[model samples]
Target: MSLINRLSTRSDDFLATLRKLLAFDASQDESIERTSADILKDIQARGDDALLEYTRRFDQVEAASVAALEIPRGEWLAALEALPGEQRQALDSAASRVRGYHERQRSETWTYTEADGTVLGQKISPLDRVGLYVPGGKAAYPSSVLMNAIPAKVAGVAEVIMVTPTPKGTRNPIVLAAAAIAGVDRVWTIGGAQAIGALAYGTASIAAVDKIVGPGNAYVAAAKRRVFGTVGIDMIAGPSEILVICDGSTPADWIAMDLFSQAEHDELAQAILLCPDAAYLDEVEAAIARLLPAMPRADIIRASLSRRGALILVRDLNEACAMANEIAPEHLEISTEDAGKWAEKIRHAGAIFMGRYSSEALGDYCAGPNHVLPTSRTARFSSPLGVYDFQKRSSLIQVSQAGAQTLGRIASTLAHGEGLQAHAASAQYRIKPD
Candidate 1:
C-alpha cells in the first residue's frame, strides 16, 4: 500500500476528491457529552463534595480535602529549581520568549476627542481570573502550560488557576516547573469534566473563573461547551494541521520530516504538501517511505499520513497559494527562496512559517508565537490565542452638553422613525428646548 495519498490539480474531479479527503466528523460522542453533563450538574449542585468524589473516581487519587490536592507555591518553585541546569535553562528561555511575544499583544485604553467635544474610545481590561486545563495521565506537555498561562499573565489577569489530573497520584515535574515559569497563580490535581465544572461553577474551595483555556479529552471539551455561557472558552480545536507549499528548492527530506512533525500529533492530524514540480513530490514520497521506519511514533505518523496527509501537484506557485487559502490550515510553511513574497498572497492561516528554515515545530515551542492556533479551516475566521483572548474591550463614550443636543436630536429622530416611543422620549429628554 502507498505510504500517503497522491493528487493532482489537473484531475477532473480534484475539488470533490479534496473535499472528501478533508472531511472530518467533529460531532461529539453522545455518551461522553451526557456523562460530562451529569458531572457538571453534580459538581454545580454538590460543589466541593462532588468535585472530590469525581477526582477520586476518575484519577484514582484519594485526598482528605480539596486543599490537599492544591499544589502549593513552594512546590511549583521547587519544581522549577530542581530541574537539571540544561532543562531549566530551556524552560526558562521558552517561557521568556512566550511572555515577551504576548507582551506586545496587550491592548491599551485609548480615546479621541471629536470636534464637538465628544470623547470616543475603547477601554481594555484583563479578566479577573482564568482557568487552564492540562491533560494528565502519562502525557506531559510543558509547552501547553507555557502557551496558555503566559498569555493570561501578560494580559494582567489577577489570578490563573490550573488543573491537571494526577493519575495514581503521580505528578509530572516538568509540567509543574512550567506552571511556575509562566506565572500560574494556583494549581490543583484534578482533571476531566469535573475539573472543568469546578472552574465554571465554583466549588467551595475554588472560585469561578472568568475564562477557561487549554486542551483536554472529550469529556473536558464537552464540559467547556456546556459552560460557555457561564464563562468564556478558547475554542473547540479540531486537529493539528500543517500545509507546506514548496517551490521545489527545499530538501525533500526536510519537507518529509515537516509532514511527520504534525502527523505525529494524532491520527486525525493532517499534513499536506503542495509543489509545482511533480519530481519533487516523488522525492518527498520516497523520503517518507525511507524515514517512516525509524520514527519513534511510526505507527501514529503512518496512520495520519495514510488517512489525511497528501502530496499534491499544483500548476504553479500561484495555484498552491490558492489551494492553501482554501484549506486555511492551522500552520502554513512557505518553503521557497521568496517565501515572504508568497506569504503576502495568503489570506488565511493561523500561523505562517516562512522560508526553508522556519519549520512549524519551532513555532510550536520557543518561536515567540502562541502555539494555540485555529484549526479545521477556522483560521479563515479565527486567530491564534494570545493576550487578546484574556482581555476584553469596553466601548468608551462621553458627550458634552452641547454635543448631546445634536446627538440626542438625531437619536430621537431615528427612534421615532423606528416607532419606539420610550426610546424617542429618552433621547428627546436629552435634547435642548428650541
Candidate 2:
C-alpha cells in the first residue's frame, strides 16, 4: 500500500476528508516571536553594537564593526568573474530574461485634461531603496537574488541593499555573483531578525530602506511581521506548494517525479495530484515507490508525501480544475492534452504550468515570471512579486475654477451628510462665491 493518502470523489465524505488532508496550521511559534521581538528592540536601541553582538551569537561571525560586514562592490564583481563559464552564462541568461519580463510590468505616469481644464492623473514613482534578504550557508539560493532584486531595479529603485547570513564566516560565491548580476547596490553579511531589524530600523553602517523583500526562517518571518508598519514587505509566505491536475494521459513516471519535486522542498511542503483514472493513480504509486530509493532527499520526500501529500481521484478534468481553484495552490500544473482548454477554468493559482513538459522547477529558476509567489491559498487575493511592488502611485488632482465650482457642491453635500461641518465649509470655500 502507498504511504500517501488516497481519496475518491465517489465517497460521501470526500470533501471533508480533502479538507482535513489540506489543513495546515500556520500559527507563529511563541518562542520565536518573543525572541524576534527582543532582537528587534535591541537592534533598534543599540544600532551597530547590537547588530554586531547578534551577528556573533547567531551566525558565529565575529566582527569588530558593522561596516566590516558590508561586502564591497569589487568583491561581488570578482565573484561573478570567478564563476565557471557555464554557471556565469546561465546566470546572465536568467538575469536577462527576468529583467526583460519585469520591464513590461513597469508603470508610467499618466494624466488627462478635462474640457474645463481640470487635470487629473496618477504619478508613478519608484521607492528610493529596497532591502533583499537572501538565505546563506547551506541554504543558498541564487535564483532568489534575481527574482527579488531585478524587479526592484526594473521599477527604478535607486538602491537595492542585500542581507545574507554568512554562517561561520562562510560566504557562497554564487550568491555574491548573483548580487552582481542583479545589480544589487550593497551587500551586507547579516541574517535573522537582526538583519530584518537593521534593514527596517537602520544602523550606523546600513541605511534604512523603504521596503524589505525575500524569505528566511521562522525568526525572520516574525521580524518581518513586527516591522511591517515601519517598512513595506512583500508578503508573509507559507510553505511551498504544488497541486497537479492530471488527466491520466501523462506518463506515470513524469507525474510521480513532479510530486517528488515539491515534496523534496521540506517535510511540510505540500504536493498533491488529482486525476480521474484509478488505474493511473496506481501506476503513479508504483512509480513513486520505484523511484524513491534513488532520490538524494528521499527521507524528506517520504515524510512530506506521507503527511500532507495525497492522490485525489476526481470525477473529471473539470472537477479537478474546480478543486485547484478552491486550493489556490502556489503552483498548479495542468498535465493533460489541450492543457490550455482546462486552464481557462482555473481562477486562482500563483503560477500555472501548462502542458506535461512545463515543470514547476523550470518556473522556479529561468521561467521569465517571478518565483516569489503567493502561497497557502493567498493567490485568491495576493499576487506574485513584480515591478509594481516596488513602485508607488500618487493621485494628482488639479481642479480648474469652473471644475471646482461643480466638484465643490458634490463634496459639500456629502460632507454635510457625513456630519462633518468643517469639511463642508472647506469645500464651500473652494467654490467661487456667486
Candidate 3:
C-alpha cells in the first residue's frame, strides 16, 4: 500500500527493522530439521514406495513408475513445435545468451611446474550428474529452466536432470520447450521434498544426482537442506528481495514498477528504495499509489510493501550505499548517474543491476547471470548459482625424489605439531630413507 519508514530507526534499531523487513520470525521455527528427517527416513526406508506416497499426498498426482515420471522424448519435441513462433524464438535467444554468458564461467584445469619439476595444479571437471528442481503448479517460468540448466551444460556436466510438479497430471509445454533449449538430459513429473529425495537417494525411477538446484516453496527449501550432506545444493534461498538506489534522475513510475516486481512475488518479499532526497521518495510513493490497484496481484504487493518494503531518505548516496550493504538484498539496482561508480561501493548483494536500461527482470530472464541468488542477507557470504555449482575441484600434486625430501620434512613437522604420529610417519617415510 505504501513504503514503510525505515529512516527514523537508530543504527541499533536497524537490525530489528531489518529482521521484520526480512520477514524473519524470531519466534517461528522453520521445522526443516523435523520435516527433512522424516522425508529422508521415508525415502531411505521405502524408496519408490515412500516417494510415490508423498507425491500422491502432497502433489495430488500418481506417478506409479519411473518410466511414467519422465516427460516422453517425443512429447518434449512436440512441446517445442506446439509453441507460437515468437515464444519459441524468445526461448532460443535467451538460451543462447545464457549459454554464452555461462560458457565464460566454465572452470579450466590448470597446472604449474615447480623449479624442481614438481607438478601441482587443480583439476576442474563437471559433476557426473546434476538435478535441477523447478517450481511449477502455480506458475510456469521458462526463464527458470534456462537460468538453472545452462550453467551445468556450460560446465560440461554429463547429465542434467529436471523435476517439476504436475498438479493436473500434465506438464506445461513451455517448460518442456525451455528444457529442450537448455539441454536437459531428463525431465520428471515429481516435485517438493519427494523430488529432492528422489534426486539425492536415487529411487527406482529417479537417478541420484551430485547436486540439486532451483527455487521452491518452504517444503522444497527444507528438502534441499535435508539432502545437502548426501548431495550438494545451490543454497537455502529465502524470500525474494529487491533494493533500488536512485538519485531522482529516473522516472518515479519506472522505479515503483520495479519495486512492485519483487513485492508481487510473496507477502514476505521485500522491495526497498534508498534515495538521498525525500521528494524522490514521495514521487516513487505516488507512482506506487497510482500503479498498485491496476496490477493483478495488488493485494500481495500491498501486503509486501506495508510489511517489508521501505523508503529510506539518506543524507547522500554514500549513506544509501551503507544502508543497502546493511540490507544485502537479493537484487540491487543502481539507477543513479554513474551507476558503475556506486556498484563499487556495494559490498553485499546477490546481483547488482547497473544503469537505467539494466532491469532486474532482464537478469531474471535473458541476462547472462543466473537468477537463483542468495536472499535474506545471506548474500554477504553466498553467491548466485552458476557454473561452479555443477563442478568440483580436486588438487593435484606430484613430487620427485628431491622435491619429496624438501616438502616431506615440513609436512612431518606440521603433522607432529598437530599430534598426528601416523601423519608424521607417512610424510617421514618418503624422505627418511631409500
Candidate 4:
C-alpha cells in the first residue's frame, strides 16, 4: 500500500491517469443504459410482474406480492424499540442535530414591491412526497437516514418514504430507529433498481414520489438516471473523492488516514495530496505505508490508492488550488496555516474543510452539511443535497399597466431582434406610446 507513480512522458500525463482513477469513462458503454432502459420499460409496461421478477433476480427476495414488499409500521417501531436505550438515543440525537441544522435552511415565500407597481418574488414549497433509497448492504448506516430524510423533513415535505433492501426477514434495527427518528412516513423492504422503479412509477403498494434521493451501487445510479425525468433526483453521484492541500502543518499520519477514509469507498475512489514541499510528500507516503496495514479495509484502500490516489508535487499553493479546482473533488481539505485564506481560491469543491482539525468524516455524519454530494468533477457545476433539493421555487411576477408598458417595449424590441414575432407581439400588447 505504498504510493506508486507511473512515469509521465509528458506534463499532462497525470490527467490521463486521473481519468482512469476517477473511472470517468467506465459507464460510457451503453450496456447499462440499454439494460436499465429495458428494465424500466418492462416495469413501466408490465408493472408488477417486471418489478417482482427484478426483485427476485437482483435482490433474491421471494415476494409473492407488493404487499409483502411493504414494511409494516409496527415492525418499524418494534425494531427501533428493540434497540437498547443508548443506541436509540444516539440515533435520536443525530436526527435532532440534522433536523436543527436543516431547519435553519428552511425557506419561506417572499415578495418585493417597487414604487413603479411591479411585484416580483418567489414561492417556496416542499414536495408532496419524496422517496429515499437507503442501501442495506455492508453495515448499517443510521447516519445516512438522518442525512437524507432530515432535510426533506425540515423542508416540510408531507411524506418522506424510505425504501431499503432487506433480504428475506433481515431488517436493520438501527436503520429502522434512524428512519423513525427522521420522521419517515413509510418504510419498504425493497432496494436496488427495482425500488427506484417502484418510487419513480408508483406500484400497487408504493406511491409515486416527487423526488428520489440517496446513495447506492452502480445499478442504483443507472436507475436514478433512467427515472430522472419521471421524478426529481438529487444528483448522479460518482465514486467518493478527497483532495488534501497541506503546507506541512498537519501530521503525516493524520493526512494519510484522512486520505484512506475516502479511498476505502471503492477502487474508483480517489485521495490526492497536492503539496509544494517534497519532504512533506515523502513523510505522507511513509505514513500511508505505516497506516495502510492497520486498516481493516486495507485491500480495498490499497487498490484504491494504487489505482486512483496520488501525491502531486505542485509548485506552490496556487498550483495546488489549480489542481484541486480541475479535479473538483467531493471533499477538499486545506491543511495549511490560515487554511481559510487558502480555501478562498477553491471555487469548485462539493465541500471545503478549511483547517487541519476538520476531517472529511465529520462532514460525513455529524456535520450539518450534507454528505451526499457531487463527485467525479461534477462539483464544478453541482452542489450537495440540501433543503433546496426537496423544495421547489416558482417565480412570482406582477406588473401594473404602467409598469408593463415600461418593460414591455424593451422586451418586444429584444424579441424582434431574435426574429420571434409572436413573442414580440405578446410584449407589444402592453407597450404604450408617448
Candidate 5:
C-alpha cells in the first residue's frame, strides 16, 4: 500500500485538504503543563534539594548534591580529545563553519548625530548568560550543541551553561565534545522541567540564565513556555517540517530521501512535495516504496509520511512557489533548474535549500545556517535562531537641551493622547519654556 497522500490542485477541495494536512496542534498537554508547573515551583522553593530529587526520579541518577551533577570543563575537553580523529575533525570543522557564519551576523553598536545635536542610535550587546538543553542518552544531538551554543559565543555571551540528562549515569561523549568545541562554559547532568527551572530560577549550584534554548520533550517545552517571562526562549517549536518544491529535474530517489530526512525525525513531522509534474511524483512514490525497507528508522518515516505527508500536483512552478509561501515550512528545498529564481518568489520560510544538490540534511549539520528553525508555519512572523537571538538591542537617545525642546512636545502630545498623565508630565518637564 502507498503510504503518502497524493493530491492535485484540480481537486474541488484541494485548498481545504491542504490546510487540514498543514494543521499542527501546538497546544501544550494539560497533564504535562500541570506537572511542569509543579516542578518549576518546587525547584523555585527548594532549589538544589528539589533538583537533585527530580534528577534521581526522572533520570535514575542519584547525586548527593546538585553540585555533584556538574560536569567539569576539563571533562568536555577530554571528550573532544577522546573522540576518533575523523569525528573530532568533523566536530571542529562544523564548529568553525558555524562560528564563521555567525560572526557575520553580529550586529555592531551604531549612532547617528542629527542636525539639532541629538545623538540617536542602537546599542547591541549579547546576553549575560544562556542555557542550552541537549537531550541525552540515545537521543544525543551533537549538531544541536553547535547550532545553539556557537551563536551565543559569537554574539559575545559572557557564559553559556549546558544541561543534559544522563540516564542511568550514561553520558554521550559526542555531545560533550560538541559542547567543548562550541565553547559551552558549563554542563549540568539534569533534564526535564527541573533542569529548565534551575536555568530559569537559579539555585545554589546552577546560576540563572538570561535565556534558555534547544529542543526537549513535552514537559521541557511546557516548562519553557511557563517560564518565558522570567527568561527568553528561542521558540516553542512544534514537530519538524519540510516542504520540497521539485521541478521534475531532480532524481526521484534524491527527493524521496529528502522527504525521509525529516519524516524520520518523528511521527508527527510533516514532509510535503509540490510539483507541476505528475509523472515525477509517481517516480518519487516508486522510490519511496523501493527505499523504505532499508532504512533503520523506516517505521518512524512511514508513520510520519502516512499521517502528515503529501505529494501535491500544482499548475506549474509559479503555483508551487505560491503554495510553499503558504506553508512557510521550517525547512524548504527547491530542487529545480535555477532554484534561486523560484527562491526569490518565496516570502516565508525558516531556511531555504537551493538547487538539486543542496539537501536539507546539510543545513541540519555542516551548513553554516542555524538548524534551530521556526516550525508550525511560524516562519510567517518568526525567524531562524541566530546570533541576534542571543543578543539584546537597546535604543540610545542623548538629547541636547535644544533638541529636547522640539522632541518633548511630540512625546507629551502622544503621552497625553494615551491618558498617561504622569508620562505627559515627565515629557513636559523636559520642554523649555519660550
Candidate 6:
C-alpha cells in the first residue's frame, strides 16, 4: 500500500475528496475543557495558594510560595552566557534577524487635521505586558520562546512574562537562554491551565498580562480559550499544514523532504502537493519511500502521510494555484522555475516560500518571518503572528467648536432616529446652549 493518498483533479469527486482531506475535527476534549475550566476557576478564586498546589501536583515542583516558581532574570542571563559558542552565535543571529524584521512591522500613531479644524486619526500603542507560554520538559521549544517573546518586545510591550512547565522541576537551559536573547521581562516555572489562569486573572506573584501568546497542550489551550474575554489570546492554532505547488522543476528529493517537514510535526499535521505532472509525483513518492528509512522521525512522518498527506495531480498550473488559494495552507511552497509568478496568484497562505532554494524549514527557524502561523485552513481568514498582535489601536477624534456645531446636529438627528433620547439630548445640548 502506498504511504500517502493519491488523488487527481480529473476524478468526478475531486472537490469532495479535497474537502474531506482538508477537514479537521477541532472537537474540544470535553474532559480537558472541564478540567481546564475548573482549574481556571480555582486559580481565579484562590490565586497563589491554588497555583502552588497545582504546580506541585502537575509539574511535581513543591514551592514554598508562588513567587518561588519564578526563574530569576539572572538565571536566564547565565543560561545565555553558558551556552556553547556556536549555539550562542546562531541564537544571537536568529534573534537579530527576527527583531530586524519585526521592527519594520511596528505601527505608529498618526492624525490629520480636516478643513474644519477637526482632527481624526488612530493612536497605536503596545500592550503593557504579554504572557508567553513555552512548552517545556522533553518537548521544550526554544524557537517558540524566540518567536512569541521577540514579537511582543518589538511591538514595545513593557514586559514579557514567560511561563513554562518544569517537570520534576528540571528547567530546560536552552529555553531559558532563549528568554534572555528575546528580552523577556520575567520567567516563571509554571505550566498548564493554571498558568493561563494566573496570567489571565492575576495572582499576587503572577501579575496579569494584557495578552497571552504561545502554543500549549489541550489544558493550556482550553484555559486560553475560556479566559479570552479577560485577556487577549493568539489564535488556538490547529495542526500545522504545508501545501506545495510544484511544476516538477525542483529536485524530487527536496520536495519529498519538504512534505516531511510539516508531516513530522504530528500525526495530524497535513502535507500535500498539487502538481500537473503525474510522473514527477511518482518520483517524489519514490523519494519519500527511499528517504523514510533514515529519518529520525520516520514513524511520525509515515503515520501523518498515510493518514492525511496527499499527492494531488491538478489539471494545470492555473488550476493548481486555484486549489492552493482554496486550501489556504499555513505554508505554501511553489517550487517551480518561475515560482514568483505563481506566488503572485496566491492570495491566502500564512507564509509563501518562493523558489526551489527557499525551504519551509528556514522560515520555521531563521528566515526572519514568524513561524507562529495560522494552521489548518484558518489561513483563509487569519494571518501570521507579528508585532501587530501585541499592539492595540485607539481612535482619536478632536472636534473644533465650529466642527462640533455641524457634528452635534448630525449626531442628534441619528440618535433621535434610533430613539436614544438621552443620547439625542446630549448632542442637542452641545448644539444649542439652552
Which pairs of residues clash in candidate 3, taking residues 3 or more apart in a chain or in different chains?
none
For all candidates in order, the CA lDDT equals: 0.95, 0.94, 0.86, 0.84, 0.94, 0.93
Q: Which segments of model 1 are wrong by more than 4 Å?
A: none
**Per-residue CA lDDT of candidate 5, range 1-434, in tens?**
46999999999999899989888888777899999999999999999999999998999999999888999888888988999999899889989998999999999999999999999999998999999999998887999999999999999999999999999999999999999999989999999999999999999989999999999999999999999999999999999999999989899999999999999999999999999999999999999999999999999999999999999999999999989898999999999999999999999999999999999999999989999999998999999999999889999999998898888898899998999989989888988788
Clashing pairs in 6: none
- Prediction 2 TM-score vs. true: 0.98
Clashes of each: 0, 0, 0, 0, 0, 0
RMSD of each: 0.8, 1.0, 2.2, 2.8, 1.4, 1.2
lDDT of 3 at 326: 84
Better of 3 and 4 by lDDT: 3
Candidate 4 ranges beyond 4 A from true positions: 1-3, 6-23, 28-31, 408-434
Candidate number with the higher lDDT (1 or 3): 1
**Alpha-carbon deviation at 237 in model 1, angstroms:** 0.5
- lDDT per residue, candidate 4, 296-372, as tens digits? 99999999888878887877898888888888999999998998888899999999998989999988877678888
Number of the candidate with higher lDDT, 1 or 4: 1
Give residue 206's lDDT in candidate 2 (0 to 100): 93
Local lDDT at 164 for model 4:
90
Arranged by TM-score with the best first, the candidates are 1, 2, 6, 5, 3, 4
Q: Which parts of model 2 are misplaced by more than 4 Å?
A: none
Evaluate residue 34 in candidate 3 and report its C-alpha lDDT on the 0 to 100 scale. 75
